[model samples]
Target: MLTGLKTVSKKQKDQFEKEGYLIIKGLFSKQEIAEIDQTFMEMSKKTIKGCFEPIMDQSSEVEDPLKRYPRMMHPHRVNDVAMKYMLHPKVMLILSDLFNENALAAQSMFYFKPPLARGQALHQDNFYLKVEPGTCIAAWTAVDKADLENGTLLVVPKTNNDEIYCPELADSKESFTNQYVKVPKGLKAVPAIMNQGDVLFFNGNLIHGSYRNKTKDRFRKAFICHYAGESTTKISGFYSPLFREDGSKVEPELNPDSGPCGNEFDTVYPH
Candidate 1:
């Protein structure tokens, strides 16, 4: 058995190790969540070049709501609010316990799963990160109420030990991303319903994704960040310039040249 948590309950740590994921309730206070909401809501109106490029024409109709407001990648590189929360002390503490060492932040993403938009297909994080020996972990914070109807995250429990499988083409009608990892027989997808301020931390190899948003009024927004343990030696170049918990940066050895997501192409899923 592993040592108990430092700041979390033994049950929480046990669940994370056994199920490969844990949901920490109200990890951020109301005021903090409000600030995060306000910051990203305002950012949604503008684009930040390489970090976030949204369709400026609000009236230009497109079939995909993602085209109007695509997911913001690496917002911490451009926005202080994003950076502040990305290295949140409480999150860092939990991560330290999980990794049994310091946690290094790799990437931050703001997903605006607007109403009628598609969800990301089920996939493994290591397939993209390619962390050597050890793997990455994710802290997914919900900025809005997320539920099954709105297409919140769906995780397949006990799959964290599975190898990264070759992804198949996803159905474009439902998934925003093109690649998908098929669910093994005998396992089931469980909805990870989260309120604003709640965070779900999961292993890199977890089989997880979401379905298309069917809600007409509610939008599921999330701030997700990836991290590698202190013991990690190499990772994908795309996640270069990792960060320490104190807002400082660290550069790890880059993984050997290879396909972006374990596939034959270097093309990454824009979602």
Candidate 2:
């Protein structure tokens, strides 16, 4: 147990199973959130090779904020604090109950959605993770308040069991990523509005994405991690080296890069 937070209840689990997503309020404490914010804040001041590339100087009036604060990919591989949260006990425990088995940490990403930054296009996570036998799940922790004006995440309900669809090219002007999945007929995208310390967990197959950060001052930062069930035997090559809750590495077989989206549209983890 994490102090004031209660363990996940059956009702919560049922909501996740039925709606394909669940939001747990204050999963991370204020102190923990501060730690994450500080870690990334310091990281933004320098470049970390493949993990993070930021144009430290953004004083120009015309410079894009994203260029100076692009999303940090696979940061857990380089930062201990990121790895700590990726395998946070409370999150791992909830994943265990959700998957009915131990959960393996597969990937960690930190999005610094600075003002006026373009959002990711709608897409299914399994399109990239490709976990065999079972799909991946995301534990997205908001490091700052996220809402429509700040480009919060948007998700479509009842799409967890749907097959991964080949995405169409998204409008380059609005989306940072090219891939876009159309919401199924009759279903609409809803905002997963969250406050600092809140964590939203969603299925790998769920259709989700965000829009551009329209606000001038707000930054919708988030610490996102993906996990697979212990039974998973293979995953995308990009995320080959998974980690267990105990901080031990687990190398699952590499799932082929060419997946449901086909070779022409083979998914790549955005750098």
Query: Could you give candidate 1's per-residue lDDT for residues 1-271 as a string of tens digits?
Result: 1243236678888888899899988888789988998999899887788777777675642566777877888899899999988888888889988888899998898988988888888889888898877888999999998999899999999998898888898877778777899999999989999999899999999999999889888889999999999888899888878899888888888886523332212235332
Query: Which lDDT values do the candidates have, in the order given?
Result: 0.84, 0.87
lDDT of 2 by residue, 174-257 (tens): 876777999999999999999999999999999999999999988899999999999999998778589999999999888787
Q: Which stretches of candidate 2 lie over 4 Å from their true place?
A: 1-5, 57-63, 258-271
The lDDT, on a scale of 0 to 1, for candidate 2 is 0.87
**Where is model 2 poorest over a 10-residue stretch in terms of lDDT?**
258-267
Instruction: Please tell me which predicted candidate would have the highest TM-score against the true structure.
Output: 2
User: What TM-score does each of the candidates earn?
Assistant: 0.92, 0.93
Measured by lDDT, the strongest candidate is 2
